[model samples]
Target: MKRFFRLPALGLAFTLLFSTAAQALTPDQCRDLLQQYYIDDIPQTVLDQETIQQMLEALGDPYTQYFTPEEYKLFTSSMEDTVLVGVGGTFSLTEGGLLTERVFEGSAADKGGLQVGDIVTHADGKPLSGLTLDEAGQLLRGEEGSSITLTYLREGKKHTAKLTRTAFLVPTVYSQLVDGHIGYLDCDTYGVDTLTHFVDDMTAFSGLATSWIVDLRDNPGGDYYASMGTVGCFAGEDALSYLLDNQGKYSAYRTAVESRTMYPALVLTNENSASAAELFASSIRDTGTGILLGERTYGKGVAQSVLDQTTLPDYFPDGDAIKITSYRFYSPGGATNDTVGVIPHLLLDDDLADEAALLLSTPAPAGDTTGYLRVDLEWRWYIDLDQALSPEYQEAFVALLEALPDQVKVWQGTGGADGWTQTSAAALAEAHGLTDYTRRGFTDSADSPYRASIDLLATYGILQGTGDGTFQPETPLTRAQLCALLAQALNCKMPSGESQFTDVDMNAWYGPAVNALASMGLVNGVGGGRFDPDAPVSHEQFVTIMGRLAQRLSMVMDLAWQNRPDTAGDSFVGWSDWAAEEAWLLAEGQTGLLGNSINLLWDLPQDIDPDAVTTREEAAALTCTLLQWVGILPELS
Candidate 1:
């Protein structure tokens, strides 16, 4: 949808001078052509430039391009078997607008006497107004060893600091103790030397590290093999990534051959932690080597292919570099990590925790000495294990779910004109040619809020509407639809084949859950030769599914299930204090928009009509949402 237009000088040259009368190339022919072009662009003299261009157009690659003379250095620089060096300073623009936060943990700013609260108004004589953090970054960054002057306001006084930038090989490994002897590591980038660096830092600090925090925040990416092996340090020599070709065949990849387990790790990341960061985090967590902290990483799990690097120097005119998505990667557990970032174990605020840090800093010992050390034992480390479980996942889902009651106001239980009983469940029967059937399900469980829950759940999956615009709740749930809902609510293992069920095929949308529900003991075959995967499920079946689902989710919900000392007096808003570590509360908000429904005293997910015949579209919405909720799918593209 986004189009970028250059001068089109090259476009004209490509069309007339290079493109040839096109012919439909077979997939194999396409691969061969690309390999040939990449390995060597020079072709038979009979093969005109136009023919080559036309042939190339047959293949699709968005990141694909031919390098120019000027881009040679850039190409070689990125693809080189070395790390990219930069001036190491993390900068920030203040909320009030003129001041900037320049942090030089150990960078040029530190050596230049730039303090933490310094307000940078200008960079190299250029005003810093209206410039975003990235723009400011660009002005601050220059070639290694270059000098830039920064004008700053320090404590209501103006000052200037000129600092010469130094080439910094971004060390992939960082370690320090945070929160109760937990080691915090900021491995921002993974390169060929990453594994070595990680092992060295960890091994050196093994004596003190009870647990660790690996910060992958803001890491773009580097070599795949290098990054995989880096985290594999904790997971041992295990499968880290799997490559699936266009044919859907999976090829597994393991880290460098080794076997070792270090301290328990907790990875910290944000939306900016990307590519190798996501890949590496998922590998470690899926393999049970660590818990993920912070937020869901920026997922970049696709593998890129480099073409023309081995040859075609003359055509490239620049140093050869071409990286395109060779394929997408799956986690060691076989879950697709592309687009959907690795979901975090905890979500943290984007802003730096400066307020908390400053508040904890001890006041200078009786002042008299202006330049005194403030040794605040409390400020010495930052990390809270209890904070990790709250306001992050479970309750967030519940909150979102609770917000939906208003959205479904039209659907009433007894309104024959259009009700919860007429829309969501009966749609399955109508679509699958079961017109005469009545919906055979209801419940008086707890507030008898069954119909209300149906309205909420159905609408969230976009299922709570009928052909005549009805919401019929009395309809019996269909087997296929039940599978669909189950598939969405839990991690539906993508099937390799139409499991032992002869009735279902890979094309069946619900085939994924046929084996899953069966394995979970929530479903059983009806009589001989009847998987009844498509037949209407009974109310009895619904209760069974609900109980099993409750049991299954109990594993994930344990941390969310808090002890409420006073159940009678507890209300949703007031429960946060009692449910200090509320993961389930957040997850409830995510699933079906139950966000505001946190005040419930019941373990409600246990009571929903699991046998309800969720529609295909509804199943898609549900499964996709739950996939994101459970960390199996991406919440953002």
Candidate 2:
């Protein structure tokens, strides 16, 4: 059967139109096609360029391209995963040379006795050291029936081999059982045979593996349909991604295949993981089907459609084609991986990511499994009762376990330096019905009145604790932090462009949050074009921000309180003059805009400080309350 390819990062939305005649495409034709289908409007000046290449260059879109007949053939052939004449292996450039990452079975590399770890120092008598991976690959690839002499280093020893270039299909899926229990599947690309190969591997490992690890590191992505099918193997039949076209229309691309099985999965990613790989990772993360480990992915959220005779039959009588960026895609959660790639649930170094994943996936030992709680806190954590602790600590652990809510019992710790956390069990349990079996706990704020609120936010990832596992509940909330927290709570898209505030650095951790909220008119600068990001946010200030946000979101505010005769204007005293009206609207009654009773200064007793800074705990509580009201988070019992 012939396969249609959808290379999300480079090429997508394939419309194959076979033709026999060859003809040169005019600049006008190219400009017309782009104007009709490009993701953004083309400038008239750019369209009037004298040549096709010049017009494309003026447009400045790297993904959009005009392909000659020969180039188009090669591109289609590659997308189809056809047999190619070359040494059938993948290589990564290293200081020494090009390191062989994989050697295809029964191909030129394997037949020549080239191993996975072999570094090719020279190809055809030319030194390959210090060359780019693509440059070295160019040197190694050749026509069929051609031979090339290769000099390589294996295990610190030099070796040479004369290999004849032969036709072979590049393997896309590789699977093996790691530690005899983890199903480790490495997907190279989302190609035509990817779904089939992925299913075959899953079928092969059906009963043997208890957990699964999908490695998408360095995967450049391909075949959008195949990706949807493969991701469906884990995330089930849900809307995996949404596509938005230039005409302001939205279309959902749901998982095309049924879920094979549901197991805790750890997906590994890096900067090179793009397009379909990002789609797979984002769907898994957003749907709670898996946890992502390693670095953020390559942000390539736009897709291209190959235009040919089918799309513009009159313009293209020849076999040539033009690829145009036609749509922008988003994750099921409505987050785009365009410029800001998908952030991992757990950030890990590439060297230790696999080991950490294996450790996290392994279940607790069976013997005396009492008092142990298996929790899926970003990744899996097994909390066991350590007998070595003092009686008080042990008793505290038990009490904490018993106090855990039913959801905690069914759901899945503090992470440690090695990717697992070892903190106070009592503090973790009291905070969210979770306890760490390791020594020490969140020493600070253990007895805070807002411990529950703080931990609840942490549990849901709406807030993060200090790196030392301490919830600094008393820490004053800053304007930047508030924006960041609100952004996460609302699942806002990361904003593009520079910071609006002159004082705000766009590269800072909180910059995206501030920019996103500011762009939506939910936030404002202090004065003089400065955001004053580090300034403490007072209670009234916070309330006023929330009130503005509610208005923007069109939330229904309780009118009964606003209209009540007893609710005098003086009741909102102590609030800043500029914030008095908003304060009343956000916290005047039980069914305020937040949908919960927020004890602002107006509700507090006289003489109580009204100008006090909002603490981190207060910020978390407010954010959580808003989330619950908006149905983004469930109300805690």
| Top candidate (TM-score) | 2
Alpha-carbon lDDT, every model: 0.48, 0.68
TM-score of candidate 2 on Cα atoms, chains taken together = 0.60
* lDDT tens readout by residue for model 1, 401-479: 2222322211113323222222232443344344333432223212332443444343333242344545444445578
Instruction: Please give each candidate's TM-score.
Output: 0.48, 0.60
The lowest-lDDT stretch of 10 consecutive residues in candidate 2 is 1-10
Clashes of each: 62, 12
**Model 2 ranges with Cα > 4 A deviation:** 1-87, 90-101, 112-165, 177-182, 204-210, 236-240, 246-249, 261-264, 319-325, 333-340, 360-637
Off by over 4 Å in 1: 1-58, 63-76, 79-88, 95-107, 113-162, 165-189, 200-211, 245-249, 257-261, 269-274, 293-301, 308-325, 339-341, 346-637
| Residue 165 alpha-carbon offset, candidate 2, angstroms | 5.3
Choose the strongest candidate by lDDT.
2
User: What is the per-residue lDDT of model 2 for residues 420-444, given as tens digits with 9 covering 90 to 100?
Assistant: 3333434555554344433222457
